[model samples]
Target: MKPWSFLHISDLQPGSPRSYRFNQAMGENADTAYKQLGEVEDVDLLLVGGDLTRDGAIHDFECEEARDRLGSLPYPFYAIPGNMDTCNKHTSVAGATGRDDPRLNVTAEQLDHFALFFGEFPWSFVHKEVRFSGFYGAVAGSGLPHEERMWRWLEDELPPAGETKHHVMVMHYSLFIDSVYEPTWGLQDKEEYGRWYFSIDQPHRSRMFDAFKRSGVDIVLSGHIHCRKPPETVDGVRFYRCAGIAMPQAANLWPDGDTRLGFYRFDVTEEGISETFIPLEKESTAEGKYGPGGHPHPEDRDYSLAWEEPPEEFRT
Candidate 1:
């Protein structure tokens, strides 16, 4: 069976000096990973999940810097916008007041800038027998209009009734699993602030998941939880959350000490798909700790190397 490999990373919010430093380190890591991948053989593409910025600030230089770093790779790369990347008002409010606010609006300028930079790709695409789609922002009703339009596109674009193979959907937010369902880690509790971001209600989220299942999407990639954990399977759709490339934060709305900073790699073949988590090297971790002690740390840091084999269903 022919094989293909691609890099998957998320939450590369390069805003503050700390964010910049983190991204620099992540860029270095990506280079190392890519080199190692090259040694192994060929890598077909790089898929970056979202939250590419800190606050979606128009003046944020990190965005450009990130583009430069990511662009250095030899492989063709594609990306989507996360809540932070979307320029929604919540980011500004949270930044200015240091408090959660849900009354924010996604600015026209931010959307325009993102579209210009990203070239207005569809919410989804197909490459090498793999179908890829992504949804932006949180899953709440706050961005309903935009979310609706995206869904409409997805519904229209879904391969006709019974198409199958390796179908993968990538999004900034997790539709199934702890990130969206578990009360403690789910976005429901954060409804007030979530409204400013994005998150659909229970019925809508369920409906979305059903749509993916019906569409025969085998795997879903997401990031925003910041915790490096195994992929969770629900209703036959496997959801994998890529760890943030920058500073770590609370995992799934959990208290501060449960996040891990890292990235992921997906290997695809005619047979199936497999994913592995490539964590920051020891030197990088130490730098993350000593260089900036301010960032939150995970409890009982389980940085040990672990790989979650794709469930039986995903093994084509």
Candidate 2:
């Protein structure tokens, strides 16, 4: 076999100026990434790690637009849903953010909406002796039909996909914050919001880890944290906490966390997979009026502030 390359990027949630919420800088950053990604050559595939839109949960147009743009890539791209694209991870109790966490919980309809646009997820396929698999780990324990599918796929379907030279698993949320044994983050604790927001909770985390081991997964890629952390090799598997292309976050949370805005290029060959970080050619310095960040309530959204007229449907 010959060495092949692929690109992995995520969290390009650069919402449009036509929406009630728009950040010029974030949008430009994503544009930069989009342009830069197109310039790369000879890539076998593009693995989109999710959060492809800012408000895809509420707006179908965002998903359609994203599909068109991503479709323009030179190579085939595989995708999964991020919180912004579908909905935030399931939360039984309200979080410390004061936002209605339960209300923000992921819904079946939203997952259907995402699938309608981006195709069904919890998918697995083999290319060039490597197996690429993606799933929405956030759906675990949600009791939604998608959650059941996720478990069945991970447990039954993926593990038996036959042996491959390498198995690369893509997930939206980090399986754990620092260690696999780390306790589930508490949403009610103000200090744990970042941890809670970024990771999978409880027994689901352990189950997924076990399944990965059984499936002989060589590498795991995750986004949603925005910041990239140093890769951790547990047992024999290498887990990559990927960087976000749209913006950076959780800079101060982890001592080794890198808030650099970039994507990853992996070269797989007989020796091993070599990872390289490709920073955006230009970081957008553009700025504009923006509403309060961090999941504002619908009532608080002000469409009148948009630089462009908000679509009639989005207007409140």
Candidate 3:
């Protein structure tokens, strides 16, 4: 077969200035990546890792904007929902952030809202000889219907469609922080909050890994950390902790983490699939913003500060 290429990008949370708070840099970075991605001549469709919007959980228009922009690309693409698109990972108790973590838990409605635009996830299909699959594993313990459906798909459904020269899996959350067998991270612990926030919790974590191994998923592409790490190969599968398009993060979390902003270009041929990191052509230096960041409480949002008048619906 002739060699072909595809691109993988995630965490492009280009927020709307219409929203209460906007990170100018994040919005610009996402725009730069999107434009750059379009310029790349690809042989196959793009694989969108997730977090396509800043507040898609509450703003359907943002979801629509994302869908329209991505849809305009010359090639087709598949995507899963990020925590920002749906809601945070399921949390039983408030974390060290002092925000209402319990209230921020992912909901069925939010998941369905994302699917309404992006399509139902836990979806997999064969393209040429390779199999591309995407799932939101954060749903694993949410006790929502999506959680059960995702598990069912991962266990019974995924293994059956076994067309493989290579199986590339896209997941929104890292399966683990440091190692596949790492223990469950505690949300209540201040120092552990970052890990807890970025990773899929246990039993679910182990089960997901089991599914990965059982289905012969050799390359697992994960986002949500916003920082790329040196590829980790375990139990024969290689985990690519992809970089964030929205911003850099976790500068001190991992000694080897690469905090550059970029997307991955993968080349597939007889030798097998090879990955390359294509740094964004331009990193937006645009500045200025209104309102707070990081899951701010509703009362904290002052829509009047928006550069543009937000829609009446979002003004609540």
Candidate 4:
């Protein structure tokens, strides 16, 4: 009957100066987003789509700070771990990128460590006649014990849990890149590597879609790719590839892809849910950092280039 609003923000990896790499623009952009979030009114809750920190997988301080920073928001938030917070998706074969992909696969301990700060994920609850569900989709193909639990939860637990006026699913990675049924992208193919890195693979994507349908999910919000594309509806579900809070990536990769930096605001009412893009007041131009961009090998990291002293463990 009455209307309410909620927010979806992701990839605000406000990097720490204490790390080998520190991007000042990202930090400033994240700060701007935080201030803007504080000003928004009548929002029920925030669905943090993930990548809450720059290097949460390795640095406990970053995880702790991300928790505290988000906790300062005007309302409560339900969050899931992004790849940066844990580790990249599982891959036995290295990609076109020089990084050792398999060695960087998300570990069970990494997942648990993330939970230590953000709480257990694959979580669902009903708020204001709307069902909100969040999960780390990367775990689907991880082959870890958590993968079994994720499957069990998606297949068995959620379908019969209950019903609601609407269901919104929050995930870090987009379920698909271009189309829901697109062929799986390959890691070895340089042209297809970005798509492969950004989306869930074949059987898993279809399986998740089926589970979402069975569970009455009408809307799905995801971030990982950072470039927001026009919403794509497959079957009966509307999939929104949300904007990033940090910086834009792959903006020109898609014809309709929007390169703006910001987040999404959704209003729910008796009619249904309507969404809007809230672009950041200003994109950060501040720049300064150490180390390299993209995933860098640990051995290749150079703490000596850091402006501030890095943590003892990070310094070689």
Candidate 5:
């Protein structure tokens, strides 16, 4: 099959009016990055990982606005939900509701809103010789019925009982990496409202990874960690964790502190897949907006967020 190029972006996180300043900064950064991608000559598809909003409140229109902005891109775009995405309620379709009203907490309006904008959950499509399937918020132990359905779909699609060139999976949370530590970081934190967020417990993690292993998926793309690193292979599957578009987070995993805001480009072919990290030139340096005492409040002594060099493993 002919080789094709696609843009992968994640963690837009549009804050609400109460946090308009944050949203504005993030939106500006995202717009600039999207424009840069458009300038590239030969891109086919756009894949947005998740965290489209700061909070999933219907009042927080930033996520919808951001989606419209991204839809203006030259190529077709696909997306999935992150933990922050589920913050708002989703209304059920007349016949689409699950048993036990799995989406009982979701409002019909919210569900309709998401469906109208993003389409049904656990959506799938095929392009070229590749099969692209997405699992919205399929972290280990989300316990959400939709998440479980997505997992089942993944198991079914993995080893497509027929001939296919490649299988690619997209989701908001990283399945292989340890994004959630013992403490509340990443998306695993338990919110005060009794809502269990994105962390995947041991059994679920094992089952999910085992399914991936059994299915022989070629790659998994995720975006919750917000690190500026290239794809890494785990259990024979390549996992590409796209960087945040706005407000690069301090490297929680590494003490040396490697943090920068950027996205990735995947060049896929029958031969193999090549991925590159495209650092945002406007925000590349540690000066100005990202300088010390910037909005994200990087540790004063740690100039690492802007200057720290990436580890050898991140070099690709």
Candidate 6:
């Protein structure tokens, strides 16, 4: 069979100045990634892992802009929603500090709004003998109606969907921090909060892992961590903790983590699939930005500090 190539990129969150928050560096970084993607050659397809916009859930204009930017890519790209594009995972208990967790819980309305620009997800399709599947894994334990549909799709629809040479799965959150059996991280534990934020919780993780096996998934590409972890193999599946396009994080958390801004290029040959890390030719160092970091509460947002006049649409 002839060889083919594909690209996987995520977390571009190039925020809008019109929004309550703005980050100039992240905007430049995502623009750089976008330019770089056009230069990549012989790519059969592009897999956009997620975090396509900074405040896409709240700002409809951001989502619309992202659709145009990504649509301009040289090759066809399939995408899944990242937490930033919709909402964070469900949690009734508030975190130890900062924003309340329940407020961050993803709602059906949020997901539906995202689909208005990016199309419906938990999508699976075959191209060139490869099964490319993408989903918002953060929805797993949310208890939302969308979560029910996600479960039904993963459990009932995909596994039976015909065979393929390789199944490449794309998700926004890593299924686990390290091992498949690692305990879920708690929101109250300062030491474990990062872990908790980056991974899917228990029962759900194991359940999803099982579904992957049943569906013949061989490679799992996840991007929430923003740190590039060396590929790990569990059971028969290869898990790739992909690097971020917008910014880097959790560099010191893992000894081998590569905290570089870039994307992954995978070549599919008759033998199998191989991955190459394409680091951004330049990482943005621009400063002088305005915005509250982390998950800030709605009440805490300060539009007065915006560098540009708030767009009429964003005005309360």
Single out the weakest 10-residue window by summed lDDT for candidate 4: 157-166
Q: Which of 1 and 6 is ahead in TM-score? A: 6
**What lDDT score is found at residue 29 in candidate 5?**
67
lDDT of each: 0.57, 0.89, 0.89, 0.89, 0.58, 0.89
lDDT of 2 by residue, 1-316 (tens): 6898999999999998877788888899999998998898889999998899999988877888899999998888999999999888898889897878888889999999999989999899889888999999988889999999998888898855359878999999999988989999998999998799899999999999989988989899999999998899998889999999777888887899999899999999899888999988887787774776778788888887788877788776
lDDT for each residue of candidate 5 in 21-103, tens digit (9 for 90 to 100): 23356656666676787677688888877777654434335556766777777888888776556532222221121122223
Give a tens-digit lDDT track for model 4, residues 1-316: 7898999999999888888888989989999999999998689899999899988988998998889988988899899999999888888899997767888788999999999999998899899889999999898788899899898888998855248868999999899988888988999898888998899988899999999999999999999888998887888789999889778898667999998999999999899998999999999988676678777787777777777777788776
- Residue-level lDDT of model 1, residues 1-316, one tens digit each, is 6787877878766443333123345444444443543443367777777766654444345467557666666776788877666644222234223333443445545655665666463466777767776665443344545556666666666775356587787777666444545332232344444322333346557666767877788888877656655676776778775677656654455332235665667788766788877665531433332123222222321222112222233222
TM-score of each: 0.71, 0.97, 0.97, 0.96, 0.70, 0.97
- C-alpha RMSD values across all candidates: 11.3, 1.3, 1.3, 1.5, 11.9, 1.4
* True-vs-predicted CA distance for residue 201, candidate 3, Å: 1.1
Q: Provide the lDDT at 40 for model 4.
A: 85
Candidate 3 colliding pairs: none
Error of 3 at 25 (Å): 0.7
Least accurate 10 contiguous residues by lDDT in model 6: 307-316
Model 3: residues >4 Å from true position, as ranges? 160-162
> Which structure is stronger by TM-score: 1 or 4?
4
TM-score of 5: 0.70
User: Ten residues in a row with the worst lDDT in model 1?
Assistant: 300-309
Error of 5 at 294 (Å): 16
Pairs that collide, model 1: 138-198, 138-199, 139-198, 139-199, 139-200, 140-198, 140-199, 140-200, 185-252, 257-299
How many steric clashes between backbone atoms does each model show? 10, 0, 0, 0, 6, 0
Instruction: Evaluate model 1: give its lDDT.
Output: 0.57
